[model samples]
Every structure is written in structure tokens, then in C-alpha cells.
Target: MAATIGTETGAVLVNPAARNRAAAGLRSIVLPLGLALFVLVAWQTYVTVANIPSVILPSPISIAKYIVARYDILLIHAIPTTVESAVGFLLALALGVLLAILITYSEVAREALYPNLVFFQLIPKIALAPLFIIWLGIGSTSRIAFSVFIAFFPVVIATTAGFLSVDKGILRLCRSLTATEWQVFTSVRFPSALPHIFSGMKIAITLAIIGVIIGEFITAQAGLGYLIIFATARADTEVSMAAIVVLCICGLLLYGLVAVAEMIANRFYSADSR
Candidate 1:
């Protein structure tokens, strides 16, 4: 009877252990891939079963074929969009960080500028894209400038919050040690704010892409946004879907770059602490 009880207990424990091992092995790749496959299958089945018009909603297979056929055309349009997004994101990063530092260090600047910034942020900035075109002309410059304008706000807000979040005790200690303001900022405030700054950066990158797309929608001779508009006008839903898919890929690639940079920054800071 004791042997039977022990055997049952062992079986219960071993079963869970085996299940956990299987779950852990599958969690990262298999589960997500399986779910994505299921969704695609369902989507395909619905389109087929419903006899959906390809012009209204193309099947995933049709979109795939469209992408393959128009690969070169998509690449050509994607290049300008990628360039505009990258340039705008970089500009936003530099301007946002600089303005954040200014606002953090100067009480007068913060009082005068922060409220206005918040006000602008609350407004619909996308609505200002046409104004940017009027001011800068309908060129890549306008698109890039508009992109930078919309993407700049989140970084400033995040960075200012981070700068404010530094422990006051640390600042007092640094002052007692007769550390210069620059020294305190670099050694303490900047490092502490990195995570927040990166968080803002991630948000800004996505906004930057959105800004460029909107700009393209308003006035663009080329880009994925232009391709989407062009395809939609022709009632080529498959082509539109293909362009959208490429745009998503581009956006993901940009976001992934920021994520990689954040990971590297975190590792560097961790090593510095050690």
C-alpha cells in the first residue's frame, strides 16, 4: 500500500515536470507561430467560403502573389519612406534630448516652454501636415519636418520625467562632494534617465513612421503610402495589401533597431555599475 502511494505521487510530480519542460520549449517560437498559422488559415477559409470579391478583400495568397510580382515597385517606393522616417527620427532624438536637458536645468525655460509643449501635444498634430507642406513645399523636406514635429514631444516628456525622478539624496551627496553640475548630470541623472529615454524613443520611432505616412498620404509622388493610395484607387486590394505589408515590415525593422539599441544601452549601464 505504501509502495502504491509513492508510485502515484511520483507519477503526479513527473507528469507536471514533463509538461513544464514541453511548455518551456514551445513558449518562445512554436506557440506564436502556431497561433499565427491558425489565424491565417481562418482568414483564408473565410474569404474562400464567403466568395469575397478580390477587389474588396483579397486573400492572403493573392496578396502574397501581388507582393512577389510587384516586389521591385514596392522597394522603389519604400526607399524614400525609409529615408524620411530615419532622418526625422534622428532629428527628433537630438532635438528632444537637447530640449529636455534645457527644460530640466532651467526653471524659467520649464515654466515658459513645458505648458506650451503640452498644449501642442494635446492638439491634433496630423492636421498640421498640410500646413507643413504650405510652409516647406511638397517635398521630402516637408515630410521629414512634419515627422520630426510629431515625434519630438514624447521624448521630451519622458526625459523630463526621468530627470525629475533622480533621487534627491544623490544630488545632495554630489553637491556635498563639490561635484560640478555637469559631473552630477552625467554620472547620475543621465544614466538613471536612460531607460525612460529609451521608452520614449520607442514611442517616437513609431510616431515618426506614422508622421511620414501621413505626409505621404497628403502629398507624395512616391513611397509605400503613395503605393497604397495608388493601389486602392485602382481597386487593386491585393496590391494595396502588399504595400501595407511592406510598410509594416519597414516599421517593424525601425522599431527593432531602437529595441536593439535599448538592449545595448541597458547592458552598457549594467556593466558600468559593476
Candidate 2:
């Protein structure tokens, strides 16, 4: 492809930086995929040759077949978990950012709330999952609320750091230029904070899913977590593994969407992406 354009000698003028970026991206995807494929193949071969019982450790192939056989049922359980995680993540994102903004801009907020945030972040949220069920009942409300609680702090911390990270000299220049608070925020603070915000979001998304799964485990009504628990209770290893694989795929897709958003935000705010 590099030979298709630009060079007088029938070779294209290639960008070394762009080529390096492309290579890095390819490796990022391919290496993990290669490792996983190798591990699965090794696992399958060992299990088959050893005559291992499926109940003990089902082969990846068995898990895939189980998923194919029970995809409809699996999907039904997965949807609720996905929806709960998404709803909670969005709520956490909004509240976390708003609170982060407050804490960053207001000394009173920082003094009053930041310490409390740290305290909650340190607490064992898993232990509190049952408390949510007691408060909100055995429903999606409890699941979503629990997830929001789990995911909120990272966003606040990252965003506050991002907002405060800009050079003090830059802010001084903006003030000297008669920029209003809104103008400085819109033109500088938000754009500069996008990278860190996305960083926190990537982390929060995973935790949000975990929170929902914990709720599902406790509630035992629906979701892949429930399926996993139910299947494991009956010694259906294949079903449990299949449910786990589906959960992993769902999580990867959600995280990928966040990554895509980060890319879009970076491109749009190109000047401040760094």
C-alpha cells in the first residue's frame, strides 16, 4: 500500500509516526487474541487427552457449544445486567462529574465532601449490596443504585485532577485576557479534562458491571450472574462458563464503546487531548 502513492521511485511517502501507530494498534489487539487462542487450545487438548470431566473444567469448545445452544436464554439474562450497568454508569458519570466540578471549583465542597468520598471509596461496597436490596427491594432499582455507588468515585477523582492539571500561568493568561468563567471553562477546562474523564469512565464501566452482577448474585432473580450461580449450584460447568464468556464479551463491547468515545472526544478537542 505504501508503494501506491507519493514517491517518484514508485513508492509512497509514508509517515513513520502513522505507520508506528498502526503497528502498535495491531499488536495491541493481536497479541492478547493470540495468547487467549493458544491458552484455549492448550486447555481443550489437555482436557480431552486427560479425559477430564466437564463438571470439573469444561473445555472452551464445550463452553462455546453451550453458548450456541442456549444463546436465547443467555441473551435474555444478559440484557437486564447490561441495561442496569449502563443506566447506573450514566447516572454515575453525570453525578460524578458534577460533583467533581464542584469540588474542583469550590473549596467548601472540597473540604466537606472529598474526605467523605475517600471514606466511601475505601469501604467494602460488596458488603453493602444487601443493604441496597433492603432499601430498594429485590429489583433493578437496587442493582442500578448499587452500581452507581460503586462507579462514582473514580470519575470524580480523575476529573478533579484533570481540571486542576492545567498550568496556573494558562489560567492567569485567560484572566488577563478578560475571559469570563464560562468562557475559560468551555474553551480550556472541559477540553483539557476530557482524557482523564474518559480514563475514569473506562474504569467505572467495569466496576458498574461488577456492581450489577453482585446485586444479581444476591437477588438471584435474573442476569448472567444469576445464571452462573444457578448453573454452578446444579454442577453445570458448561453453562456457567458460557455465561461468563458472554459477560466478558458484553463488557468488552461496552469498554470499546467508551474507548471510541474517547477517540472522538480527543479528535474534536485535538488541541487539548494531551
Candidate 3:
């Protein structure tokens, strides 16, 4: 009888522990979704009760309807923006990595360029969009170039910081092993600095989208930015909101791609280490 009681008590405690673990797993997915639904419901109720003008503040339902009705138009404008942003992001990544390598490998280059790089980063980048328009014209060229310009700094700074952050002892060990400069960098410095580099790349990806949007605002004849500007001019808040929602989706998709790349790279390095 005592043994049976002990087994029953253990089962009771273990069941709750398993239940609690299950609840914890569900919480991560449930909480955010619940909150978002609550906010949408509240927003819809408030707009209905207040009799708010759709032009001023469209409800979530109205925005959803607008998006569905105008999906084709939005897609047409979204493609150019996506292409320009992707191009700018890739260019910034290449230039940033190359410049960071130069700065890391050459003391003379670092001394000459690092200060200037920081200075440029400190300046208001948006103000330079017009200058790019003047140089590259009111075309996709200007938008892409401007986006690259704004996105380049974070990558360079982040990558340079990563390269410099590697342990000196590890570097010394590599050197003692008769590792060549290229081998040392590829095997030790580059791998170690990847986290920082990816950190910068994430920031650069977002900034690239912003840069392209700003360029479209200033001069583009196409793109989601143009759509937003056009809709706002007509006081079509629903359309503008729809465009913004689409833009947010694009940004998220781009950022997710970079994040996946980072995860894969990290996994590769982890496997190599083993």
C-alpha cells in the first residue's frame, strides 16, 4: 500500500511537470498571436464606435480589403523596389567586406580610411540622396546607388570590429603552426568575426530598404514609395496603409533571408570546428 501511494504521488508530480513544459512551448506562439488578435479586434471596435473617417484612420478590415483588391497593383510596384534593394544590399555587402579586409590587413589603410569612414557614417545620409540623383539621375541607378551608400557603413564597421575581436592567442597559435596569412584569416579571423559581420549585415539589409524608399520618395517614378506618396497626396489612407504593409512584408522577407544565411554559416563553422 505504501509503495502504491509513492508511485501515485510521483505520477501526479511528473504529469504537472510535463503539462507545464507543454504550456511553456505553446506560450511563445500563443501570446503574440493572441495579443495581435486582441489589438485588431480593439482597433476595429474603436473605429466603428468612433465613426472614424476611413480617409483618416481605416480599420484593419478596410486595410485587408484594400490589400486584397489591389494586390496586383501593389505587386507591380513592389518588384522594382525589391530588385533595387537587393542589388544595393549585395553591393554594400561586397564593398563592405572588401574594405573591412583592407582595413584589417593594412595598418596604413586603416589609419588613412577608418576615421573618414566613421565621419561619413556620422553624417546625415538621407541628405545625400539628392546628390546621388544629380550624379546618377532620376532612375533605378540613383536609387540603387543611394541605397548602397547608406547600407555600406554598418557592414564595414561591423566586419572590421569582428576581425579585430578575434583572440590574439589563437592568432599566435595559427602563426606558430606556420599558417599563411590567407589561411590564418580564412580559418581563424573570418570565422570568428562572422557573428559581428552578420550583425552588421542585418542592419545593412534594413537600411538598404529604407534607402531605396527614400530615393523613391525623392525621385522615382515607380516602386512602393511612389505608391505611398501618390496615395497620401489623394488622402487615400487605406491605399497608403496597404502599400506600407506590403513594404513591411518585403523588409521582413529580406531580413529573414539574411538571418537564414547567418544560421547556415554558423552551422557550417560549427561542423568544421568539430
Candidate 4:
């Protein structure tokens, strides 16, 4: 009888937590979809009622139709942009983390580079687009390099902040225990910095896409950015909107991948700690 009562108590304690997690997951999906549907409906109605010219603003329905009609072309262009963005983001992440470690460990590096980073941040990054094209010659090489440049700063700043945010008491404890710098850093600093690193990565992913699109806009060779520019120039607003919708989908997929990786890493870290 006692064991039965204990079993019932455990279920009571566990069930609500599971239910709440499920509820939260459902809300995350439902809310965004519901809101998007509402916006699309309103947009379609307004365009239809006002008899707005397609050149000025294509209805959402028109965009959907265009997507269905030319999905093959869109897919082909999407491949290059997606590759550039992902590769650039990964490169930026690696270099940024390395630089952050240098800055955190060496006071000289912090003093020498941090101010210069700030100065570079103040400069209009877009103005460098033409220069990148001139240097890299309107190729994916330029796009990827430009993206790395754009996305690099945030990761460095966030990761450095994360490294510095470790508890002073923990450092003192490690020192008292005679833990080496590498051991302390690997066990403590990097683990604590994971959250900040992921934050920077999320932001970097979006900025990476923006950089690639901007490059494509200038190059006008391929990618959804090129598609948008081409369609707009031709006054085919539906096609432009279609390209934008696909671009957005691609961006969201990349962001979702990052989020999934974060979740997996967090789980592994937690398991390792236990």
C-alpha cells in the first residue's frame, strides 16, 4: 500500500512538468503560424479590394502561385546562397572564437584589437561591399569572405563577455586546487561561455544570410537575392515576393538547425556534468 501511494505521488509530481513542456512546444509552433496566416489573409484581401496593381504590390496568393510555377529555378538559386551563408557563418564562428580566446587570455591583444574592432564597427559595412567585389571579383569567394567579416564581431564580443563573466570565486577555488590554466579554462570557462556563444551564432546566422544576399544583389549572377533584383527590375513583383518567401524559408531552416545543435550540445553538457 505504501509503495502504491509513493508511485502515485511520483506521477503527480512528473505529469504536470511534462504537460507544461508539451504545451510550450505547441504554443511555439501554433502562435507563429496563426499570426502569419492572419497577416497573409489581410494582405490578400487588401490587395484584392483595393485593386492594387501587381507591379506595386503582388498579393500573397500571386506569390504562392509564382513559387509553385518556378520552384525549380528558385531551388537552384537557393543552393548557392545557402552554401555561402552556412560556410561563411561557420568560418566566422571559428575565427571569432579563436580571437576571443586570444583577447581574453592576453591583455595586450585586448587593448590592441578591441578599440580597432569598435572603430571598424563604426564604419559603414555596406560601403565595403563594392570593395569586396573589386577585390574578390563578384564571386562566391567574395560573398563568403564578406559574410565572415560581417558576422565575426558579434561572436567575439559575446564570447569574450561570457569568458569574463565566470565567477571569481570559482577561479580562486581552481587556483587553490592547483588546477592548470588549460584545465580550468576547458572545464569552466568554455562551458559557461556556451550560452553566449550560441547567442552570437544565432545573430551571426541571420547576418551571414544578409551578407550573401547583398553580395548576390551586386553580382547579379545567382541566388534568391539575384532573383529578387531581377524580378523587381522587370516589374514582376509576384516573382520577387516568391523569391523573398523562399529566402525567408531558407533562413529559418538555418536558424532552426542552429537551435537544434544548441539543444543537443546543452543536453550533452548537462549529461556530462551529471
Candidate 5:
């Protein structure tokens, strides 16, 4: 009997590490997923239990069904907004990187413009969205310009930091080897700056989406923002919610794309996350 008891105790002790590892694996998966699942379940339950009108707050399932039913129309609106975001981001990338290079290369440029840049960043962008429409007219050009304005600052700040923060030792070695200014910048400074550029781009990408949507909200006839306005006027809550979901998905997709780009850059360049 004693021998049997000892065997059972040893078996229990031997399995504990395996049990712990299984528990950890389950936790790794479940912990993150659990919160989102809980939120969705709770949202559904609350709407059903309260007998809430769909006009007031449509259930998640209702919104999902509505999106499926109206996908053809939604796709029309989605394309314009996507185009605006992409164009704005591309412009921001070109201008922001150029500005960062200027600030790093020319002390005069930094001294003359950095203060104004900070002030420009501090001002509420939405308050000026209408002004942009007024100045540029109600078209894609104005919308793209507005979005670029919103995205440009983050890239400038982050990439400038990256350039400024490159290792002095590497810089000294470049100088010792009599590297040309362009060679030093291209080979050493730019590579070091990429991680920061990517960090800034991730932020700028999200801002670009918001800026494009805001520009559309200010003026436009054929985008997700316009769709929301039209639906709201008609008291079509389901359609409005469907448009909102599309906006959310678009934002997520943009951010994910930037993150993937960052990961790829990091892999190739061997960035040490500071």
C-alpha cells in the first residue's frame, strides 16, 4: 500500500512541468482572445437583454449581416477612401523624409523651422480641415493635402531622431576612412535611421487614414465618410454602423501593413530594439 502511494506521488510530481507548460500555452492563446470574445458576447447580450432598438445601437451580428447585404455599395465608397489614404501616406513619406534630411544636414533649417513645425503640430488639424477645403476646393486634391499635413510631422520627428541618434563610433570610423558625405549618409546614417523611420511611418499611416476620412467628412460625395453622413441623415443606423466597421477595418489594415513593413526592414537591417 505504501509502495503504491509513493508511485502515485512520484507520477504527480513528474507531470507538473508538463502541466505548467500546457497551462502557459493555453494562457498565451486564450488571454488575448478572451477579452475580445468577452466584449463581443457582452455587446450582443446587452442589446438583446435591453431590447434595444437597432436605430439606437445595432447588435454586432446585425451590423455583420448588414455589411454582407450591402457589400457592393460599400465597396464603391471604400475605394475612394483607400485611395486618399494611400496617396496622403505616400506624399507624407516623400516630404517628411526630405524635411528630416534637411533638418539633420542643415542646422540653419532646424533652427529656422523646428519651432514653427512644433506650433503647426500643436494646432488642432480638424479645425483647419474646412479651411483646406475652402482654399483648395472640394476635391481629392484638398483631401490628399489635408491627410499629408496630418501625417508629415510624426515622420519628421521620428526620422530626425533616428538620423541624429546614429552611433558616434560608426561616424568616426567613416570619417577615418575618408568616406564622402553622400557615402556616409547613404551607408551609415540612412540604415541607422530606418528603424525610426518605420516607427514614424506606422503612426503616420494611421493618421493618414483619419485625415482622409476627415477631409471626406468636410466635403465629398463618394467615400465612407460621405456614406456615414448620408446614412445618418436618413436615420439608417445599420448602414452607418456598417460604414464605421469598414473604416475601422481600413485603419487596422493600414496599420498592419506598416507593421509588416517594419518587421521586414528590421529583419534585413538587424535592428536592435532600443
Candidate 6:
């Protein structure tokens, strides 16, 4: 009877800890949402009180209404732009990682290519935008190329750093153990490099969006970038603001997706897992 009572008391104590953890998790989600709502309200109120002209700055309410009214139009352009960005970003990631691996394998290759990569990064991609347009025409291919150029640098540098930054001692030990080259890379270097690779990926993802938008700005028949230009030209500030808001939301969504991916990776492959 006494043991049964003790077990009940312990179970009761355990319940509150579990409940607290659940509540904390709930708060994590709710707090950010609440903060976003508060900021939106503040933005609308400020615009209203300041008597900001619709041509200069439309209120959140006005923008929201515009979004609702023109959802179909926005969807048509947004989808294609998003596809271009995604494709370009993935291409950049693949090429960057592959090059990084190759550079890691050969000191001569790294020495020869790294300087040229740096020079390429220094040359503004926009300066080449017109060239791409001429070469590829005002189409998806040109835009994707711009996106790849913008995103590729960071991924290449970050991934190369990740591979090179693997602890010397660990690498030496693997060598001493007569580990195969593949074994050394897979078992020691690759895992150690994942964080840096992910960091690069995050930067690349954001930059890829900007590149796509810039490409659209330069020459595109359709896209949010074109819509923004058109709306601004016509003084349709409501639609312009709505478009900007949608762009912001899209960027945030992409960043959030990366963050979630990182979290899942950490959960499964973290040091604790080993």
C-alpha cells in the first residue's frame, strides 16, 4: 500500500514537468506569432496616424485588401518566379558542393581555382546581367543563371572551409589507422563539415531569391519584380506594398524551411547521437 502511494506521488510529480515542457513548446510557437501580429498592428496604426499617402506607403489593411483582391494575378507570377529561384538554388548547391569536394581532394586544384573564384565574386553579377540576357535571351534560363551565380560563391567558400577545417588530429589518426581516402572523408571530414555547409546553404538560399528578383527586374515579361515596377510606375502603392509584403513572406518562409531542416538534422545527427 505504501509503495503504491509513493509511485502515485512520483507520477504526479512527473506530470507537471511534462506539462511544463509542453507549455514551453506551445509558447515558442505562439510568442513569435503574437509578436508578428503586434508589429503589423503598429505598422497600420503608424501609417494611418501619419496620414501617409497611398502612393508613398499604404497601410497594412490596404495591402491586405489588395492581396485578397488580386490573389489570382499574384499566384500566376509568383509560382514561376519561385520555381526559378528553387531550381537555381538547387543547382548552385549541387555544383558548389561538388567543386568543394574536388578542391579538397587536390591542393593544386584549390590553389589554381580559388583565386579565380574570388575574382569572379568581386565582379558584380549585375554587370553581366545584360550579357546573360543577350546570350540566353530574356527567359527563365537567363534568370536561373543569374541566380546560380549569386548563390554559388557562398556555398563554395563555406563548404570548402568546412572540409578544410576538419581537425588535423582526427585526420592524422585516420591516416595512421590506414583509413582509405573515402573512409577518411566520409567518416571524419564530411560529418564535421555539415554545420558549415548548412550555414552556406542558408546564405545561398536567401541570395538566390534576390538574384531571381534582380533577373526579373532586368528583363522579364512576368514576375513579382515586374509587378512591383509596374505598380510603382502607376502609383498603385497598395498593390506595390502588397507585392513587397508577399516577397517578404516568401523569403521568411524559405528561411524558416531551412531552419526546420537544420533542426531535424541536428536532432538526428548531432554529437549526442554518436
Question: Per-model C-alpha lDDT, please?
Answer: 0.92, 0.90, 0.94, 0.91, 0.92, 0.87
Per-model TM-score on C-alpha atoms: 0.90, 0.88, 0.91, 0.87, 0.90, 0.83
What is candidate 3's TM-score against the reference? 0.91
Best by lDDT: 3
Number of clashing pairs per prediction, in order: 0, 0, 0, 0, 0, 0
Query: How well does model 2 score by local distance difference test?
Result: 0.90
lDDT (0-100) at residue 167 of candidate 2? 75
177-244 per-residue lDDT for model 2 (tens digits): 99999998988898888888999999999999999999999995889999999999999989889999
Better of 3 and 4 by lDDT: 3
> Which ten contiguous residues of candidate 3 have the minimum total lDDT?
265-274
- The local lDDT score (0 to 100) that residue 108 gets in candidate 2 is 100
lDDT of 6 by residue, 184-207 (tens): 888878888889889999999998
RMSD of 5: 4.0
CA error at residue 30 for candidate 1, angstroms:
4.1
Query: What would the TM-score be for candidate 1 when compared with the true structure?
Result: 0.90
Q: TM-score of the candidate numbered 4?
A: 0.87
Sorted on TM-score, highest at the top, how do the candidates line up? 3, 5, 1, 2, 4, 6
Give the per-residue lDDT of model 5 (tens digit) for 1-274: 9999897678679897786788799999999899989998999999999999998899999999989998999999999998899889989998999999999999999999799999998999879999999899999999999999999999999999999999999999999999999999999999999989998999899899889989988789899999998898888998999999998888888888888887888886875664
lDDT computed for candidate 5: 0.92
RMSD of candidates 1 onward, in order: 3.9, 4.6, 4.0, 6.0, 4.0, 5.8
Q: Which digits, one per residue and each the tens of the lDDT, describe model 3 over residues 7-64?
A: 7688678797876678789998999999999999999999999999999999999999
The per-residue C-alpha lDDT of model 3 at residue 69 equals 92
Residue pairs in clash, model 4: none
